[model samples]
Target: MSTLAYGCMGLGGGWDNNPVTRENINQAHQVVDTALEVGINLFDHADIYTLGKAEKAFGNVLAERPELREKMIIQSKCGIRFADNEGPKRYDFSAQWVSRSVDNILERLQTEYLDIFMLHRPDPLMELDEIADTLSVLKSSGKVRHFGVSNMNQHQISYLQSALDTPIVVNQIEISLAKLDWLEEGIMTGNADGRDINFTAGSLEYCRKKGIQLQSWGSLSQGLFSGRDVSHHPQHIQQTAELVRELAYKYNVASEAIVLAWLMRHPAKIQPVIGSTHLDRIKACAQAPLVTLSREDWYNLYASSRGQEMP
Candidate 1:
């Protein structure tokens, strides 16, 4: 496996509001084509994307190109519920809800089974045994081949693992230069005695140690690096931009490649979920696998983000 998965969040919502655009659909198809061409074997998706519009769009693409399914790994998440123009959203991890959600995902994607299905987020009121039993049934029934979770901390993962027979394969978390608290202590830094350190202790390093793939969302820092200027941001963004520019020139590639390279440089083998809606940007992301940043450069970028040298 390439250890790099392409994210399809843009297909549902995020950029523009044109889900029906022929140009957009064609661009998505082009992304798939490019991904396969460049050896990207994994595709990340969520059921709540654009209120399910994203999966429907991708389903159309898969239906049109049936042969591509056999060549790629398709992963999707569920458990989030949205209200109608009002009220707070909710999460449901009940057995019935999970079963129905998987069925709906299969129907929307026009597929019989998903390679991987994840709980979109940890439900505070969820019963570990119930969730595990549901996943166990889904796996045995062939509705899903694997199970995982998104935005889950170490404690949540440990709790679910203890109740489930299956091993969790991946932990999808928000990881990027802008998000590094997970790499350090769980403390969010700057706050006194904070409970949530932005992530759990040893989460990233633990994933690296345990062979659980750390899939990075917000890989491009929500397109912050794509901007042409960094004057309004902190000095770290500027410094990182300079290093990215330097590496881009050396590699003869886009600055995005440097950003991806920085993530890839980590020992954890981080797989970035590219959120770009542009075909050209997707292609640029593909080039990231080819660009190799030196240890010094990688640490330099890291230091810039940390605002200090590594001890």
Candidate 2:
């Protein structure tokens, strides 16, 4: 699989009841072309993105170009439910819901099997044996090839894995130059200030030790250090942006690439999910793999983003 994935959250128009327009499908086609041109074979989706229109739009593209399916690794997530008449918006991990969600996901994606099927979030009321049985059935029936999770802590992962017949292959979380909690938690371990960090301690290391892939969502940081205006921002952000631009110029890649490179430079081999719908920005992000930051440069960006020297 490619280290970078094209996120389909921006596809199929807005989050309203409006039906998908032909323009939406055309836009999906363009995004697919650009991502494939840049060697991104992994396409990520969620059942709730644009109320399922994102997957529908991509399915339309695949329906037209059936050959494209063979060239891609498609993964979609479930377990997140929007508020409906029966209940408030919440995560559902029940056997009935998981089975139905996988069916819906496959139907929307227009695929016989998903390369990966991930639980989008941890459901507090999830029954380990029940959910594990549901996933096992999906895999046995050839609806989903592998399983993963997002936004789960180490303890949650371990408890769930205890009942699973197969290994969890991926853990997606918020990891980027802008979101430093994953890194900060590690460096702040055993310090009084570490209590303020929100990340789960040992989560990153647990995944690494178990050989689970660490995927990063929100990896671009909303163009914070890339090209967005930051004049009114704090001095640390301004300095980070300046440093990112300098590195981009030196490496002959986009500032977006530099930001992503900083994350990719880690030994964990984090895969960044690029959510940009713009062609230019997508192209800019593809250049990330081409530039490898030096050890000193990596620390430089990390320290600059931290606003102070590391302890």
Candidate models: Cα lDDT each: 0.80, 0.94
- Please provide, for model 1 over 1-311, each residue's C-alpha lDDT reduced to its tens digit, 9 standing for 90 to 100: 56578887767444344555565567678778877777788988888886677777778788998888888899999988876474578888999989999999899888988998999988998987888889999999998998888999877887888888778888899888777776546334444644556566667766666677889998888656655578988887877777777778887888787888889987788888886766677778788888778888877877777766654
Q: Summing lDDT over every window of 10 consecutive residues in candidate 1, give the lowest-scoring window.
A: 186-195
Collision count of model 2: 0
Measured against the true structure, the TM-scores of the candidates, in listed sequence, are 0.90, 0.99
Off by over 4 Å in 2: none
Clashing pairs in 2: none
**Per-residue alpha-carbon lDDT of candidate 2 for residues 70-90, written as tens digits (9 for 90 to 100):** 999999999999999999999
Q: Using alpha carbons, what is the TM-score of model 1?
A: 0.90
Please tell me which predicted candidate would have the highest lDDT against the true structure.
2
lDDT of candidate 1 at residue 188, scale 0 to 100:
44
How many angstroms is residue 168 displaced in model 2 relative to the true structure, after the best TM-score fit?
Answer: 0.5
